[model samples]
Target chain A: VPGDSLSYPEDLCPPDNFNMVSTWIYRSSFPKKKNFSFLKKLGLKSILTLILEDYPDQNMKFLKENNVTLFQFGIAGNKEPFVQIPDDKISAALAVLLDRRNHPILIHCNKGKHRTGCLIGCLRKLQQWSHTSIFDEYRRFSHPKSRSMDQQFIELFDGREAWKVIDPKWI
Target chain B: VPGDSLSYPEDLCPPDNFNMVSTWIYRSSFPKKKNFSFLKKLGLKSILTLILEDYPDQNMKFLKENNVTLFQFGIAGNKEPFVQIPDDKISAALAVLLDRRNHPILIHCNKGKHRTGCLIGCLRKLQQWSHTSIFDEYRRFSHPKSRSMDQQFIELFDGREAWKVIDPKWI
Candidate 1:
């Protein structure tokens, strides 16, 4: 159910008036091991790395660090999860790994918008996050929730350095 | 990751299968519960009841005696990780679950296969099932894998069902 489009947008980005116990850790810029130190400050632990093949080598370095446990999924870094997720869900999933205590986590995709948003949303749902708060993140990000959401969102996955000769439009 | 399609047939069907452990349970069918009783006689503990959600009023008799957990997940059932999983991957999933010690869990979707397969595969991967065994289940069960072992196999998804009926396809 990760590919959700509409509910996810609203779920990831809800109106400010919503009441929820959610937090966002923007580890998009921090390659794998680099941010563990900062995450330690936030009291976060573990990481669910939504890796695409083209992700920079820097991120891998962090993964090699001692404290991080990886939940790696090769969804072609270019492609993102189906939709945004609620914060409470994140709370619940974190609760799963968080119960481990003070292990700072970072959920990252190459660019860290769609896949990370979707994973966090799913995690929020797992934690029983209110639907309203999930939508708040989407509203704040202000990414288009468009007719072409799938294809447009797919653009975040554009990681290839070389085009395959079989690319349809190129033909 | 439930919709994963693999290139190998063995991925779907593992050889020399082991019994699955049941950690989760659901309420579905009476006869199935009887089957659970039969398994129990063989030293298996079925933790979940399998109740056919399509027919809600049904009470699984064994559940009253054994106290199995009950749950449902729309048509997709328990396959939150994925709506549909590959055939062979799913088969391996079953094997891994069975081999687990006293962890015989019951999982189902609205019907049972899609989510069951997805969750099973996830459990298998999480449990450290071998690379060969994992591929075996994917080949044995997944329809998408039957076509081509392409990235699209992983990308295949059933569109959002609960979204507003804006497009004819949404309905």
Candidate 2:
């Protein structure tokens, strides 16, 4: 009954790489104007974006109208020896993700490949999923452009640190 | 809090290609004994399998012990001009999927690629997802082994037929 009342006269165009991460968590590439109707169907309470750039005006308007809060934990994509994703930022994002108040949230980055994948991978760790399963999911979304640096980041992430901030009841 | 009480003494190994399809629907490759502990954490009410072979004794025992109902709609894999997946079986599976009583159901096949992908693709159509978005998801799980025949089956499979049998409230 969640989405039954919503009228769908035509097909919904979900953002690229869109997929459900868990019970109320979703992941996708950066959403566009065309994807707004589809996003509305999710009845999202919040959107956690991993992009560093300022949000576009159109998206801001949509969020405002829908009363969906935005939480941005910007981290640059892991780019080899020069740039590395900050662990603290990811941990903070995990803390936000662990709260049920933010249920029905959508997590996204530019391509939803590296930054978002890394966050979901870390979340999978908290869920006690084996590294093999976590990496399998990571690579599934990353596909042709999977990054080894991102995988290493997930491997090295400390779930204990995440545990410190998250509510046990929410986990 | 849905999974908060599930104890995770050790890392859990989910079946290959396991993912949430919708609110209460999950898709994965055939479950193995090693993945039992992880499946237990899902609190599944039932499992719907698409393989033509008889259910394995071990799996049957797991379902019985866990009180998970099994719904098998056996259909041959779409193997080009020779073997075609029957439309009626997929339609029947969709009918099961659209019912809320079968909530938290796991759908699987041998590889969780072709036949499973085809079935999920049709479900996406019922949800009013665009064909481009549908095929993107199909290819993501199928990956290197994506089959055009299965994609065609999804494209040609009529959602109107599925709508006939499904409850309006569940949609």
DockQ, each predicted model = 0.03, 0.53
Off by over 4 Å in 1: A1-45, A54-56, A76-102, A142-171, B1-171
For model 1, how big is the iRMS in angstroms?
A: 23.4
Badly placed stretches (over 4 Å) of model 2 are A1-9, A169-171, B1-9, B169-171
lDDT of 1 by residue, B1-171 (tens): 111212112211111111122222221112332234333433324433223344233334554556543332323233334543344444333433344342434444332323434444343343333334334343333333232322223334222321212232211
Q: Report the TM-score for the A-chain of model 1.
A: 0.46
Estimate, for each residue in A1-171, the C-alpha lDDT of model 2 and write its tens digit: 424432556779999999999999999999999999999999999999999999999999999999999999988889988899888899899988878898889999999999999999999988889999999999999989899999999999988777667776765
> TM-score winner among the candidates?
2
lDDT of 1 by residue, A49-93 (tens): 665464455644554554555655545432235543333333333
* CA lDDT scores, all candidates in order: 0.35, 0.91
TM-score of chain A of 2: 0.94
For candidate 2, state the interface root-mean-square deviation in angstroms to 1 decimal.
4.8
